[model samples]
Target: MERQKRTTIYDIALKLNLAASSVSRALSNSSKINAETKALVLKTAVEMNYQHNAMASNLRKGSNPTIGVVVPRINQDYFSNVIAGIEEVTYSRGYSLIICQSNEQHAREVDCVNALVNQHVSCVIISIAAETGTYGHLQQVLDRQIGLIQFDRVVDELDTFKVINNNETASLEAVSHLIEQGYRRIALLEGPQQLDIFRQRKAGYLAALRQHNIPVLEELMYENAWTKELGAVATAKLLDLENPPDAIFASTSDFSALGVLEVAANKGIQIPKELGICGYSNEPFTELTSPSITTIDQYSFKMGKTIAELYFEQTEGKAQIKPKTISIKPKLIVRKSTRRK
Candidate 1:
């Protein structure tokens, strides 16, 4: 038996007794075509199971109808939620998202950016990896004139559109909260200072201490304590110090804060009374811990939406959108861990 031929506009036009040009124009929704004709054309097209040639449509509009999203790790709660928010808006606008993960490496991040560029993606959204300090790869995207929008963990050197939380402000608030609870000798577990976000957080902690008239203790600050194990190591060292800190600002992320809590528990240190703790990134697990961790909510999903909408506004030739840095203020989520008795 012979295979059936695919349906086309000509077939629909023949059945409806309309000219092919009229049918095509109606299907394309040309404003010149009458509404009744368009409705009839659409109804007939649907009945004929005619699949619109997406490639032809995109070429005509001079767009790929796809956005490229590159994250350090898609498994992480923060990145995953951000991607979801991007999908929510882009899907409705007839755009598809092509996602890539960098696995927290500078080399991989560069590769991902290059891959997206090759695909001719209309826009590229990124949350830079922890190890990415030199932003030549990011600059390449900008050089290519691709719409590049960065969110959450972003590079500061690149003068591009960005949707980011006020990391320094959030860190300052967290430190202030700790100080208000009478945590005088507060130690900080910092992530890699190479990334702008972590660097801002570290600065915020220092500023808060200065504002409260607390002397800067160089010994209490540990740089590159980005992981749980590093947090545990930092905690051990801090606790062994002649003047151990009464509180710990785990500015790295919630994982680091969890380490602080676990180590304190093992050492028979009571929370809040003996050792106060605070974290960043408001991870879900932070709330379920024995004494819920005090953290900063960066509104990750909203940041993603903001990035997507900004990209569209810039790419679609809307009113001249300026290349301005939009900062989303983070909220301090106080929990039992940081509460003073």
Candidate 2:
């Protein structure tokens, strides 16, 4: 039941009655160690099941070929795809990835970043938490000259490499689609106002209303409804209103839009017939649901690859560079959820 002790160079040296340094040189196949000794140490290493600590050696040499990524949640399809994209590029470059989740908390995000910094990672890629309060932790990364790349939910004050989706334009296009469907008096399920992405989404929603000469009703806008539960609660409240909205846009996330669809179905509200629905982030489940949700595809995988490529090309791949911002435009995926004529 007890775990076996790992065999180190010292253990191999003690067993072979050779100096630890000689054993290390033999294991490394160094020229200083003759072929006979190298072969003997290697044979002994196999017998002892000795493993090399390449990372520890690399760390001591100040060349940690590892990248640290911090995201809100790995369970979410968007973040998972992003990580996979990053892996594709990093793996090819002979680098390893250290992934950490922030769980949408500022404190945890700081802790993850700090751990990455302590590890002396080559780069730190992050999509900040919803609680956008301070920049000290992020600033420390730049101070240490460690490559920092911020994507999606980024803070404007931080002058770092950024890869983001054009949330405003995407949201504008989504809302405009709802309007063209003749859905007047549309309601919005919003995210936290502190984050730029949410604010940009709100701006896009407002911009669309203004573009179509539609009056903006403050009452129809529900704040902090980025989750499925909040979206359902907002839907129930809006549906109960004396003059309920004919369309609901869960601009926060696909999860929120899913909530809207469920509440509408339970209330016998025909989607795109009596009420239109739309969501952001084209999660996998969005397409599978009956009356599939109309949502915006942020190309999360492409975004991830872009982030990784940017790090290699800009950070060490280039000699000198300025802080760059790369914005990827999201596409609108119209499905059965909002296809009314």
Q: Write the per-residue lDDT of candidate 1 for residues 255-300, one digit (tens) a residue.
A: 8888899999999999989999999888899999999999988888
lDDT of each: 0.89, 0.93
Give candidate 2's TM-score.
0.93
Q: Give each model's clash number.
A: 0, 0
C-alpha root-mean-square deviation, each candidate: 4.2, 1.9
Tens-digit per-residue lDDT, 1-341, candidate 2:
99999889999999989999999889888999999999999999998898889888787777888999999989999999999999999999999999999999999999999999998998999998987589899999999999999999998999999999999999999999999999989999999999999999999999999999999999999999989999999999999999999999999999999999999999999888999999999999998999999999999999999999998888575488788999999999999888987
Model 2 score (lDDT)? 0.93
Query: TM-score: which candidate is best?
Result: 2
Candidate 1 at residue 231, lDDT?
92
lDDT of 1 at 75: 80
